[model samples]
Target: MSTHTSPAAGPDAPAQPQGGRHAAGPGRAGRDGGLGGVARRVSLGRPGDPRWARPGLWGVLALAAVLYVWALGRNGHANEYYAAAILSGTRSWKAFFFGALDAGSFITVDKPPLALWVMGLPARIFGFGTWSMLLPQAAAGVAAVAVLHSAVRRAMPGGYGHAAALVAALAMTLTPITVAINRDNNPDTLLVLLLVLAAWFCQEAVRTGRMRALVVSAVLVGLAFNTKMLQAYLVLPAFAPLYLVMAPGTSLRRLGHLLAAGAALVVSSAWWMVIVDLWPASDRPYVGGSTDNSVRDLVIGYNGLGRIFGSGGGRGGGGMGFGGEAGAWRLFNDIMAGQISWLLPFAVIALVAGLALTARGPLRDTRIALLLWGGWLAVHYVVFSFSSGTFHPYYSTAMAPAVAALTGLGGVLGWRAYRRSRAWSWVLPAGIAVTGAWAFTVLRRSTDFVPWLAWTVAAITVTAVAGLLLARLGPRLRLRVAAVALAAGLAAGLAGPAAYALTPLGSAVNGTNPTAGPAGSGGFGGMRGGFPGGAREGGPEGDGGPPGGTPGQNSQQGTTGDAVPGARYGLPADGVRGGGPDGAMDQQMIEYLRRNLDGATWLVAVSGAQGASSVILSTGLPVIAMGGFTGSDPAMTVDRLDGLVSSGRLRYVMTGGGQGGPDGGGSQVTEWVRANCAAVKASEYGGSTDRSLYRCG
Candidate 1:
């Protein structure tokens, strides 16, 4: 590597030497007429690195897509709670537009309608099915990867941008919690998307100090607020320190931009708040988690407080917050461990090496960015750990990017350091191969390695740890080699889930229905006419699963579409059934229940996320809430509503498919009525995961 250059490779040269000594022989000239005459030097955008969005981006995309599909394939089983939100549509043409602008009154509270609308598209056109419901979250996951890449690159140092982005994307996209969110149609996906978006804008505002960017940032942040209230607001503080530190003056102008962005956020978010505000307070679900509260409290208070102090103690939750063996600091450790579980064997040593060592100045920003991102995650985790009440690990998703960025930074920095110290180049490749093998041991999924797998993983982890340490002091190249290999191995681990999703889907949707595609109504492996038992699912693409009480894609009817004459409210996709009860189960249920009970009303104790689905399915009857249940809950007020059953007023109580494993054994309400009242009749459900008809017990 000589600093000196040949006469031809003069001042404004291509930095490095061009083609072999053979040279640009013959008529190779810039203004030459023939192809042979064309002369151009290979262009490397990032100096010696030619890739733009580096190999990691594509690698991540591929992995993410693969993982997304796998998750898709593994999409809802017998469960229909979260699976059904994907089916909601604008009821009428007017509602379609108004619903888009209406905070989506029909869906569960906790967030705005943008994400739901985005996800509803595929389901609607594809016909409701099992996996089709997850498409939107998957799309959001991909977009997040892209945005994070640009943000880290432009705002951070040492060119760790690529590594940081790759890791962040990997962490966020691969996390179990993220998988849960994407599979379900809850608001977490939307909230996370908006948060990331706001952060991206924040980066822009900081880097360029552009008023427009700030305004964009503010508006997005506001939308995030609208989506999930204070959960999105956290984006401002957690991200602002670095941004403000890098500000380019113009304080007054910056203020104006911030103000404008705030205004956008408020206005956009208020569409629902205003409406919900106008309604009687009792009508709003301002207290409960999903069912009872409006979008505001769920997002602003419940979700927000939970993120800060956790919701375990009493946060209206009673489950294991972190799902581990500790609390407070202990809990934080558990979270960190879970987040970086795959990298557990080497994370610490890698961090030490990255920090105790330094690379080219070009790597500074990368390092800083990784640290900041990591800090962001750590901060959120700490907040949750110390929360007064209970909390779910999914709450820590915000920090996933940081963990990945740190790993990526470690890999890149280690490699750079090894390059600077040519003393152990041989060791580099050997260490890489070994480290890669170990990483693969930890990350790779091989049913073949069953018996010896645990021992092998443990042995490999130790050896891998040793290799990482030795690589660190041995030479910079060795360190980098190990880092790259490790990252590659972790990435490889995602293949299992990815490949599974890519497989073909079954007949989730009915071919006769027109909407259900080949294989099924949804993604690969989905079934037609819904799950084998016919459980509730998302709309359109739903493979037959319904929304609320469990029907099929058609169950999400009445909740979606605008109330206009021809605004896609009732129009079904190519071969799908119409949106309403013209010939659907909802129509049948409403008709049958009407015949069973002479009373104008019935006390319906329903569980599952899409109660709106039930409203449509059991049309005409005044289905009063027997009890406010959640997620496939089958309990009813036999003590109170039993009279309805006895007097032939209540008529029936519906049980859900996918409500519980194997009939969801512990349904006291159903049992109570069965023991107390005389069941008059029972009817089978279509595309449902559980029993749908109970004339009366």
Candidate 2:
């Protein structure tokens, strides 16, 4: 086995295969000259096959790069919320550390800055183009695929290990949500990458009984915590147990190792939160999504428990359901199923079967693989399914790696078990049939999303089921028919997501909330407009909300003065810049803000990042995103704005359709501004009323 071979390979395994067709009796080399010897060695991943492994791994990564990086600029600073943050971070170290939404450090984005820090490097070097800001995510996606392959290769048996690794990598790559996320600037790409790396290191630590590897694994998880806050710890239940069960150590020593690793996690993850909290509220940007202006509140209340219990206004935006219900079926619901659950049924089956089959075995490698990936899937599954907060379909991107790994490893192991015992033959066929049926059910949810997928899935399902049944013809026919069945099953699972992924989502999806599926155009064959941020008019930004509402709109309940008060999020545009009521203001507005507002600490204090981020992007001025995302956080109070205005640090204010806008759900700050500040006539800025700017005197 390789030096890094996982515990699954067994400690006594040899570096190379002991024998195969290439054994060729006695001392004869597998490649001993002539066509005869070559013919014997000519097999897929055969023992003597040296040329394919490295090349195949590279090939998978190359394909991932093509999918994730090629034409990626079309996304154009995808998720402008984060894009704007990156832009600010590149200009100032303070903004970079705080994850400030605007260059002026008025308010930070809701999450921690680790993702932005990684993205900021390229932006700092390459000057913050769409390419620079998004490349890190694409590269992370490719690395994730490579690392997943490495983990699988080390864990699975040799001959078929290569195939399993390739398939898992491809499955993850083709997952539409994963592709959508990586191609865009979403932080889940970084989160997913770090988790997979942690998994790999944990696998190594178990195999080698190395304390260093185990410590590295814990550190990565802590780092992941920094990346996405508590969401990164979702895998801890499985991760901790795996080390305890598999690591080679005595009772006391193992306890010490686990305790020490726990300390590392606390130190690594908490240090950042500690520093931010300790920095003094007045010294740093207001914690964006927190109600109390505390980073800990942002984490524990908003990003943390709010994600599960559905409290806290902005971060917890109710349910992901189109009808605004965050029910138990959310994971399998129409809107989310197509995005990430296409292979969920198959993965669940494989996990159950793999665990059951290996349950009695001596702490073997396959058992360990199942525990890790299955644990990952189970934990995320429960949280995503039951969580009542602002869970988007794209959030399921974190679950993609676990599902893909389980599918590959589980399918391969089940197939081997089926061949060895007649009783297990039922497992493979059952998994295929169930997965196909589930896929059909999921695809049918929105036929308009993919018109032809219904029939295509029907055909694949019938064929795969038929092929699995046909394998009973005889031993010789069994292997051939099963191979066809497996291939058909794989194809059946990938078909729908692949179609969805092949279409470009375009630039309008640059928001805090974006969904991906087999859908229609903004950049052709993709959905347009996202909610609650400044987006181009008539683009994807204007799709879901009330007509002529905020550029980055939301569909929360009880907001006064909207045509569709709770009808989804932002409205989609007609692809015409500056066309109708829903159209965002032209660049002239930005130029006006830039030309004026001299020497003010903040050029303008706007309701949310949606209204302010665009202005900041256009002028590089300090536009305060008063409330963090969706204009819902009470980051600023009336007194805070009064002080800014009194001190002459804030000269202009824009209000309307944000938190505490005319709706009365936002802070008293907007009302106070309205009571004191003079409204700048809309005509002065070309009759653009989406944002009603005022001169604070």
Candidate 3:
């Protein structure tokens, strides 16, 4: 087998497998016939790679599948907000395309519809259910682990690349928050997958100098942009510079390629937004989060700058401070640390160490890998740390890939330094010690949950650190000492996160804020509350109210709601139907609405998506959200309601306490309903006092 290295990969780049440019073909088959050949090709690994490399990659993927897909149905419409959208999408192609909260296309979800399109297709085919809605995210999560491994493996040199890739994949698979998000229907799961895939393509472009690869990466970024809007472009800072510095070709040509790629990015990202913005507003659902009924405004205001500058027209208006006060320590705070920061400190140390170690290497040295992953970490760290927006702990999933990659690379680099350079031997032990200490601190925050694990991790850290340090002094015993040190160090580093990651398997996670671990496990304490009508604290039993209910009220009534059986989270198991954050309507209300559709275009109009989502899910019918997701978007007006009512398209209006916007303010539609519609007695529909049904027109 011959080896070929791209000029950009440098002379020291890892040797490619046989068959020259078209490796993983006859060259591999002819040398290692039968199963061995298949394994080599399946792994896409180098000739010197160990046999375990293939199985190790497979093992990581298997672990991820279990973490993401196991008992997924138990979640049962995890994030019913998105689940309702998926259900709508399953029933109506228009709703699917627009990410509408209802089949009638009254309002689109706050973000774009790509994720809905991804999850919707499966749900459409499989019949809408918990598994169909969430499985795509699980598959994407596993694929992300695989891609991150490939990116790290290809960037590092020789057999060490395989080891690093395995470590990176495992770290990502077990990163508590990553597990939680993948198990849910949130767009961030797909966003992380796309960003990592973009990284993989960028790494390929750097290695091969292929303009096509770079362009593909840019397209993936654009798709990611469509998935979550502005959040996808965060990788540009890391990707563009890495290619500019190390991609093969003259500076001018590389710049030209990037310019072309940037053009591709703009086109792919804007196409949908353009289409939506240009569509006649009356013909489509109102752009959910925008103050004006415009996709452009929604993108630039609610989903874009609103997230960064904290001034927008959506719910919380980006100033909700859901992830705690933004600062350098935000990621390490109790609300977030258990979710993603378990390996963050070590990844940072690894970044610094890896960069310093490769400082003198050629332009395409392994330092490019460090910069790619390190820059990603730095950019997200800064933005997430300081962005005073409506943040959630699951938002930290964006940082997991970078942190995992750096940890793997840094670990390999540290081991190599320890073996070859006496002066740098301390780097390996230092990283492990710091990681162990941080893990202990994080574990202590949940002492009751895992009383013995913190001290056990501390003891292992001391042993591993001591072993690694002493191995430096005794050359004869070094190999044995280092082996034990490596095992203990890995255990010490992964133990805390692995434990937290398993918590989701034991019980249902909060679909809305999807954090790992049992309640009070150093995760966000107010998970149930903070959203518009959700309770402020103490799960569903607290005084703040059932999700989507008025403050100081509990509207759970009737038979157990449509929340899938086995749903252990705060979701109402009582006869409350409409399983959304705006609070569920009693079964009788759903029945009344169903029986009285009577040629009405919509079964009912409610205050917000929170109020409308559950009804849409329960009835599989169109309902109108008078306001949008946050209940603040000017999606509805008194005139629109009167027109619909007069046209005999809207017959029922559910208004009052639980239906108000996030700010507890009522819209003109609500006022008009109160003035012109006849209120039905709560006893008639089995509805709570806080929520009354008004018959209009």
Question: Cα lDDT of all candidates, in order?
Answer: 0.44, 0.69, 0.77
Candidate 3, lDDT over the whole model:
0.77
Tens digit per residue, CA lDDT, model 2, 1-697:
1222224664224335445542436557535558865554443334443345556666777878987776554444467678778878877889999899977787899888999999888777756666666778889999999899889867765545666677788889888778777877778999999999999988887776777877888899999988889999998898888888877877667768888889989888888888888897888888877877777887788788887887655365544343134666766765677677788888989989888877775437767888899999999988888787767667888999999998887777777666666788788878878877887777776567567786787788789878876776676767777777778887887887776666543334434444566442111223533211213333322222221212122212214443431122233221111111242445445456556777787877766676566555544556777766756676777877888889888888766542443213334665687789887765676644545567886
Clash count, candidate 3: 9
Q: lDDT score, residue 644, model 2?
A: 87
lDDT of 1 by residue, 1-697 (tens): 1111233543123334234432344553443345432332222223332243355566767666654454243333222322333333422232222222111222242345455566555555665444455666667777776676666555433234444455556655665434434444555667777767777676566666776776777677677665556656655665555555554776665566656666776786677667755666433322224333454555644455544554533333433343343345543242333222343223334455655553344434444454455555556555555655444444555555554555555555445455554553333234334444543443333333233543444454445455555655655576465664454444443332222222223212211111111122122222333231122233233332332222233333334542321112122221211111121224334444556556534434333333433443223223332222223211233454565456554555554433341123346665764555443332432232223445564
RMSD, each candidate, Å? 10.9, 8.1, 6.3
Consecutive 10-residue window with the lowest summed lDDT within model 1: 509-518
TM-score of 1: 0.61
A best-first ranking of the candidates according to their TM-score comes to 3, 2, 1
What TM-score does structure 2 among the candidates reach?
A: 0.83
Whole-model lDDT, model 2: 0.69
For model 2, where is the 10-residue window of minimal lDDT? 572-581
What TM-score, over all chains together, does every model reach?
A: 0.61, 0.83, 0.89
Q: Which residue pairs collide in model 3, if any?
A: 548-582, 548-583, 558-575, 559-574, 559-575, 560-573, 560-574, 560-575, 561-574
Stretches off by above 4 angstroms in model 1 are 1-56, 71-79, 82-112, 155-173, 250-265, 268-271, 279-301, 306-315, 318-322, 325-340, 344-364, 388-390, 418-697
